[model samples]
Target: MSTATLNVRTGPGLSYPVLTQVHRNQTFSIVESKKDWYRISTDKGEGWVADWLVTRESTGSLNETGQQGTVSTNGLRLRKGPGTSEPVVTILNKGDIVSISETSGSWLSVQSGNAGGWVHKDYIDLGAHSSASASPSKNKEAKQGVITAGTLNVRKSPSLNSPVAGAVHRGNPVSITGSVTGWYEIQFGKSKAWISDNYVELSSTPVEVPATSSEFTGKITVNSLNVRSEPSLNGNIAGKVSKGEKYPILSERNNWFEIKLKSGKSGWIAGWFVQKTVAGEQKKSTSSTQPAGEKVTILHNGTNIRSSADVQSNVVKRADSGETFSVTGKQGNWYEIKLKDGSTAYVAGWIVSIRTGSGSESSPSRNTSGGIRNKVITIDPGHGGRDSGTIGTRGTLEKLLTMKTAQLLADKLKSAGAEVIITRKNDEYVSLPSRVSLSHYYDSDAFISIHFDSIYDSSVAGHTTYYYRNYQKDLAYDVHESLADRLPSRDRGVRTGDYHVIRENKQAAILLELGFLSNPAEEANVTSHHYQDLAATAIYHGLNDYFSN
Candidate 1:
């Protein structure tokens, strides 16, 4: 599971384009690992994310720790805390030896020569030391299994980095003797075989019960899902449930859940598609209720609908591509939809397109409930960590000022009922394309990038709002007008910008240049807490107007 709003890139490095952005608590299975990155396999496809940004869920029963590293850079400071502002305990020069004890994001707790503190992990070169060095314990209970994987690699040790001992194909028989951290210790030809638990299915696979009582429930996060007869993908589909449907989880088997269906029969669902919830706890699910006068359009062809109260029928609805029919009534999972011929037929509600009848081209309807309430917005504080951005004449950092302003705005936005996703939560350099990818990943209603401008010419000074597309012009105008009315700086006016954050964005994205950091006087004014509050408040007011009006 990711601990922050992290980018899953095409490759392990920042140079690669971002494939998608995964937020906090979203888990994906790791297929491979290289250096400080993990190759994650999702239903969408495979991508890579920095290991520091995520916490791995070990389905296995053991955890291995302790790695060795050497300092890669000279004058790397060992700080009292994980941040740059923390006091320096001691500075270590090039080739300094250290032990990595803990990790907090990009920072690693290092100990060198009787002195221990936190240092950035980028400066430490970790060696190829194997994890779980000790051999896994032998399985006392003899077991048999069939290799589910097409070609499963038998490793010399439990670690993925271990040398390949042999290979086993599908339909091959295996004798299991022991296990460790999700790896099976099997008996191989004259040697012990260590295989990943994910590849093989034992006759009596070890069942790990996640919960026993009805205290744990699950909420369907996907638009539609199939409830099955058993806990595996091969199980027959017993029923279908739309997003936000809740069910009491009866038990767990191999990560799948046995849920008590509404009809009282227990059915299995994929655990990954459902968000676990406490039974008595209330969660504010995403908007699913239909707005008045809005009709429903079929999302897929040959979708099922109820022909009678007891039976379902597959019927085709005739309409133009993007056309919607009036919804006369809702019956269970079916909607009574009026056809092009003026005759009404019941259509499956889960397979219908969700679009507003107003047919908006200027902006996406985040929620008809109004304002910024429940709207997902992305707020990006530009240039951080290694990217210090522009430096003011008096030593003021543009990154620091932008972070301050963004945080204030984030606090206000959260208070006003907005679900905000911060591109960089701290002093971390986020790639420009990844920031844009985050907006699209979350389906953001609006994306705002906060920045401070600078140049060789200190005389130039002002605040400006920039939009890349015609659809973003309205948002730009609203925010710029508000900032101009409130700040002492000159109004640079809203204009079309060619910046990466907005130019590559598909959502309503805008960049705000709060003030010219190169101008000593302007920098002094904008960096003040009072000025930041005013700027943040103005932007908040502008967003409110844009959403409510």
Candidate 2:
């Protein structure tokens, strides 16, 4: 199949019901063709699939010495050698034909038009003219294993001294043909390759279990708990939850609890740090309504109290860390509280841990001195190394400007008692995914990506803050307002952008475009040390405002 998993329908049309799903690298026999769909014979039964979703194998005969094959996957890399470690020569799109010159374990040396390179055999379909029969091989009776490592290296030989031929990511299914010492021989592509046994889990059969709702209610007990993408610790960090945050348990695997996110996605958290609340206890806690005007302490710093119970309502003020307030009432996921001036407000219940108390003191003043203490923030300096980003008329590089600004901002955040992480400390190229991954891995409270804009029109010299999701919109506006007020440029205002780093980031992320590089005056101002300091100070204050309110 062309896709990772495609739904097989009972009929070729869109109105048909789905019979089953087929995974990538799986093969099926085509029995009939419709206007834009194909009826295939699968192990389950006959099913119809959209023609665009599958790559039909060619029935043309192949020569004994040199066979013809077609690329079966989109963006298939053709490398200089028969291994993933080799440099990529070109990329072949699906349906592109090539001449197979030779084959090495799981990899095929092929010439596509004038370009020749090695491609993984799994992404190619040899024509029927090949001498090899369509029937299963005698060695098909083998064990199955799933790669558990983030990236397991495949070596040319079983020894560690051998060159790395390829790599497989976590959750990849591999057929284990043989075992040698601490290595497992697997059918990688067109040939067999050896992978370290330590990273592969041998299984009798593949298992696909859907996440289901459970009766468990999980509460985080630690100061902060890391949520991951998979059940294993080696899995990438996805997000984090504070000590008092609660989530509904969706499933459990080993020592991890699969929990549902506010976005409706699933994430895994360490089970050891999560305490299961008994159903009876939960019921008892919510059974009796508390008296109006009861007091509750806000455990977290910078908790925003809105005019209404909804998050989108106007923010009345922010409660400082350890501040106390009177609970007027309760709304869905919100606590209605009485402000210092006897005004009513609402704060998110999840962000603040509440404890029963008597109304004694007025709301404390916002802690401006060190509200960010112990908070984690990630800074990403855009475009480095060979990527110079935008160049100004005076030859000022965007990469250098971003780095200088980011370093200054990091210093300011650190001085404010916040823990700061710079995605790139030097002039090294950091991929967008890596930048986002670093933020998640650190469980940062906020992520900022710095960059300078360049356009054909030099007149567009201003600062703009971009955010992707609704949760990040407040942060974007907070930071942008500070910069707009302090900077010596026009305000481009806050906007929704589709930038990769911010779009894919799990934390509150915002991308700041300081100024336009194409404008000489703006470039000169942004490239100066004084302006960099001002920018950094503005961002520092912006973070304070963000957290405080």
Candidate 3:
């Protein structure tokens, strides 16, 4: 089977009782095939599994050592130990090739570059030793290409619906094997993986660098940024630098800033975390003074006003479109605004337009007929295909639950007069970037990603809502509070999270952790139609409440 553990059921559908779980790479004899389920003969007994959960591989066997496995799931965690309780050492992207050394139950001991750790065996595709190896001639003939996207996703297959295998940052060199419809099959490590052709550029020559002066200075903008031996995130960590630390800029690449270390050696830091400075200028303050009492209009609806200028700072209030605020001060990229209560707060400067005339125009009024009338909402069902997400004690799949909940939520939103767009309607894989792209593509007013949580300690169960940007905090809290009030579970409270989809989305985005599937009671409750309907209704009301305010 392709999954870490495939549930063995008594019948061919979800209605059947689960018998046991079969581990990944396990061989089985097919007895029969139903619509979307398969009846197979295992060593224990005859059991049924979902057809989409496993890949049909030719009859073969592999040796324990020296076997090669390709990562088939996006952002799969590599743990220090073999279980979920263990701390995550790093993340393996889809399309990453790993050398399999040993197998422990449903986990594999794999070596990807200099790191070695245990990953769920189900997310890996094991190949025979012969096919896994490449000849010297083939290696020499492989064409090279440079990644163009800030962070390009490597998939297990060519389709956008395929499971993510790994990721490559901009300027990273990759060996291209061939091309499909709109994707490039690349040779990553010892195995083959695919990436969208739109993000890769064919190159016969090396990356060109601009000539730079002898001395340039840079300052760290973020706290505790890691310095690496190479530009890539997978590179070895050389050291760390705290915020406000200044260093001599030695060179620059796509997203990496190479700086001269105190030891006279060179180290690379993420370009996003470093602010370049002039040869002799001092570090600039994050805040500045603006004309007092100058009014500005909020261009976007639901703009957040935080206690400070930083995105990680606490959000104090939300300003709606066309709402006017008095400018009190200014931060690096934020405008300190005076609220109606005479309190000062900061908003991102990019989302507001300064008003030169009298601030007499009132904010836009909401439709009383429906909470989200004419508003576009994008609903994202979390993992799918090969990414089963967290499996429950009773064999309930988080992916299946998320899809069901997303569909229910879409129906509720549509009934409330909102235009709903689902990232995926069925059991298919969609990358985090693709989901964010869909929100922007549809010009959605709000984006909500549906997911379930899992933990080693099953007793720790709750419902949570997460937002990345400060502007999304209200949406997160509104929906979270509504859902928490309706559900018979512990409230985990709203918090800031750094998820790729929410962090990169152009529109307001939030991720809802419905409940913990690891907990027996919560899993049963969350998977029921009654609970799903309650959640859908709560979200609908929350959207209405947020838009009304």
Q: Which residue pairs collide in model 1, if any?
A: 60-181, 60-182, 139-177, 139-178
Q: Which residue pairs clash within candidate 3?
A: 4-122, 93-165, 93-166, 94-164, 94-165, 94-166, 95-165, 95-166
For candidate 2, what is the TM-score? 0.35
Give all candidates' CA lDDT scores: 0.69, 0.71, 0.70
Give per-candidate clash totals: 4, 6, 8
lDDT tens per residue, model 1, 341-381: 67667653323555455753212222211377677889999
For candidate 2, write residues 4-76 as lDDT tens digits: 8899999987668999999998888777666568899988899999875677665433112356667888778
User: What range of 10 consecutive residues in model 3 has the weakest lDDT sum?
Assistant: 280-289
The candidates, ranked best first by lDDT, are 2, 3, 1
What is the Cα-based TM-score of model 1?
A: 0.34
Pairs of residues clashing in candidate 2: 61-129, 62-129, 105-191, 106-189, 106-190, 106-191
**How well does candidate 3 match the true structure in TM-score terms?**
0.35
| Model 3 ranges with Cα > 4 A deviation | 1-369
Off by over 4 Å in 1: 1-370
TM-score of each: 0.34, 0.35, 0.35
Model 1 alpha-carbon miss at residue 532, Å: 0.5
